[model samples]
Target: MANPNQEIKFTKLFIKNEFVDAVSKKTFPVSNPANEKLVANVAEGDKADVDLAVVAARNAFCRGSVWRNTDPTARGTLLNKLAALVERDSDIIANLIVLENGKTFANAKVEISRFAQILKFYAGFVDKYYGKTIPVDGPIFTYTRKEAIGVVGAILPWNFPVIMLAYKLAPAIAAGCTIIVKAAEQTPLSALYIAALSKEVGFPDGVINVINGFGPTVGHAIVSHLDIRKVAFTGSTDVGRLIMKTAADSNIKKVSLELGGKSPLVIFEDVDIDEAAMVAHNAIFMNHGQVCFAASRHYVHEKIYDEFVKRSAALASMRKVGDPFDADTDQGPQIDEESMKKILHFVDLGKEQGAKLETGGKRIGTEGYFMEPTVFSNVTDDMSIATHEIFGPVQCIIKFKTVDEVIESANRTNYGLMAGVMTKNIDTALTFANAVEAGTVWVNCYSAGAVAAPFGGYKESGIGRELGEEGLSLYLETKTVAIKLPYKN
Candidate 1:
């Protein structure tokens, strides 16, 4: 049913189970980040478009509406159908992801496949996620029911469009909430394609909608809408704060954010240098260092610091940075020119602040937005690259003498999204795992994302979790029902 060969077809706003243009009929150009070629001219939605989407969502969410009255088990069935549709069209979806987001074909495929699994994972929870009953005092029968939080405004980030969409869309609908998605301005096609599949899967009108536009207009309207009962967002920490304030100001809407990170990865002396090198290398370098939980900060034990640095530098030199469509390519360009410039500015700041530029420090070529895989040695926690979220392929390696010192160094930044530790000693791994401020810590296994795992952050990193059973909670509200037993006189 899905044609991977078909050219980019769905480029307009999706609302109420139909593809429609924005109210103003304005369009924005989407370019391939890898080559700067035009991908599509997507419709640009603003406050007026967002208002239309909200109206459709609210109508579908009203009492006795088709979506509102759908049985929980039926809802799960619909989600499974959506998952099947996604898997069947994974090729087309992955192509869109690669073209728009500038991730390698392998990475894009993996995200699409995993996204399908995540939808299935949440599908299994549709009927199982229910509230509890408490034994309160007196003759009162107190039982609680987990109800949907009504229409949800889900805003996505460009870095991980498919995954971020899954993080919000799957669980929100599973919890019976009608959703209005504000797709990332740069990567809106994949989301729009999937929403079309939802229609084929038999989801009622207004249950799923996606709009494309810049954050200042579409994003701002979603978070500040009075009728939208909840807001789920994945983006920068600064933007997350604004979403919170705007949602509170409008109607005190429920909000959940999966924000930015300066995640750290540490390599201990006890492990094999080769294995530690790969673990630390891929953690940051994967996805062109665009991962929110990328191991941007590298802490190596003092004894093996030089070896780790050497191995890491060699790996960086070998990384293939070019077109995302290249079968053998290992990295791709930044999402856009603005992102590329920001990463370059940080690269400059790293050099100016005295961090040793071990390998790369400049853009790859004049075309596109590609940057060489970069590494810095003799880096301190105070360096700009080490402290900030560059969202690019720049890894900072810091030498540490002891566990306590490394733990302190890892926590020095304002972010705590994810951290990695490479060591054979369980005590060392457990110590670092326990003491580190990250929400998720991988011990010798640095994969922070899984369908079964709860993904989120600590402190300024974010406010709530986005996967597992916990993710569904953000879209639900518990209601307690108790009625006095009819008195028998």
Candidate 2:
């Protein structure tokens, strides 16, 4: 473990452009996953704190309020200012992420950069988003009014805290909606820091509120708050379901969920075995396999199965797992002990269910929550490791015989967030691309998504899109307007 002694600021709840203690006056300790050491004790918010945030957000979203009456182009300009601030402080944000989320320092920087890009992308759409004019029958003139959907409750995830926050906040701002951000329990400090940045960039008071707390209290409050017009979430499917129920039970607010994924990556017999194997390795191993669209299940054609597994195991074994700040370290620790133990349980399940472990399945030194990049071969579709969403650095490689067979195998799982098909054959690539049930499909790549592309999931994976032009629509409402003109004047 490397030294992570950076000074922490803004550990209190950010509401109405001010930082304050939680209503309950409780605090939770945030620790460095890399070293298993306490970083800061953040203000632990409860339902009361959430209520305060909701009040602030609703006030900001009120008709004739500064936020509600702000021009679309002005909103875009404000977003640009925030994006510039984020870019300028990318290193500091990346440092916080590395200390909290255990993301590799380099990758954390990349994630921060992507967050800026996403902000700018949504910024570009602010003034451009519009409703269409519809042709009407007889003497009627019909059109639609595109308007903001009022206050939004954004419940973020821990894996990529800032990046996922970008997915929700950027679009909400673009649509001229105020937001109450519930930072994930594990990684709250960065969100608070960003909230400060948002205020510093001249956003109106109460336009953006962020709080830190557990999912049961603060998250529930945000989801069930009646005044909030929409809720955007990025987390597990189980919690997403609860949010849906809570929203329905409260005010029937609009919701968009980007949920869990056990995505599949297919390797055809035609591609170069080594290069393809590395791509598969990086797909699963990146971010310690904590990505929602991580290629956890790799399907290799039988012809190249042996070589692929050999190369994959070798690569997994060689992956350097250590301090995230170290330039050479390839992987970091799990977020916490509970997450680490859960991952170990899945590894045990892999071994017990007759799947052969080729490389790693054990924890590293006991100081931190570090684990080896474990690879499993001879995995079947029915195994627990293959069926469950093990958000860790565990890769399960299964053998397949044909295109139809692989496609069926891929679709067998309940998740359909993203899928990858690597092949030189255009026909095979196109077929797999068309057949896959995922929201996003990459023909020759894995996890290479752009800000302009719509991203979400299918089935249990999730309910709505989170990026591209579709993202802005999630925070907006369309009101139909029909005027009957004097008959032919």
TM-score of each: 0.97, 0.98
Q: Write the per-residue lDDT of candidate 1 for residues 128-162, one digit (tens) a residue.
A: 88777888777777799999999999999888899
Badly placed stretches (over 4 Å) of model 2 are 1-3
Cα RMSD to native, each candidate?
A: 1.8, 1.3
- Against the hidden true structure, what lDDT does model 2 obtain? 0.92
The parts of candidate 1 lying over 4 Å away from their true place are 1-6, 486-489
Residues 1-489, candidate 2: write the lDDT tens digits.
234666787799999999999998999999999888888999999999988888898889888898888888999999999989998888788889998899888998888888999999998998888888899778888999899999999999999999999999999999998999998989998898899999899999999999899899899888888888899999999999999999999999999999999999999999988889989999999999888999999999999999999999999999999999998999999899998999999999999999999999999998989999999999999999999999999999999999999999999988899999999999999999999999999888898899999999999999989889998899989999999898753
Number of the top-ranking candidate, with lDDT as the measure: 2
How much lDDT does each candidate structure score? Answer: 0.90, 0.92
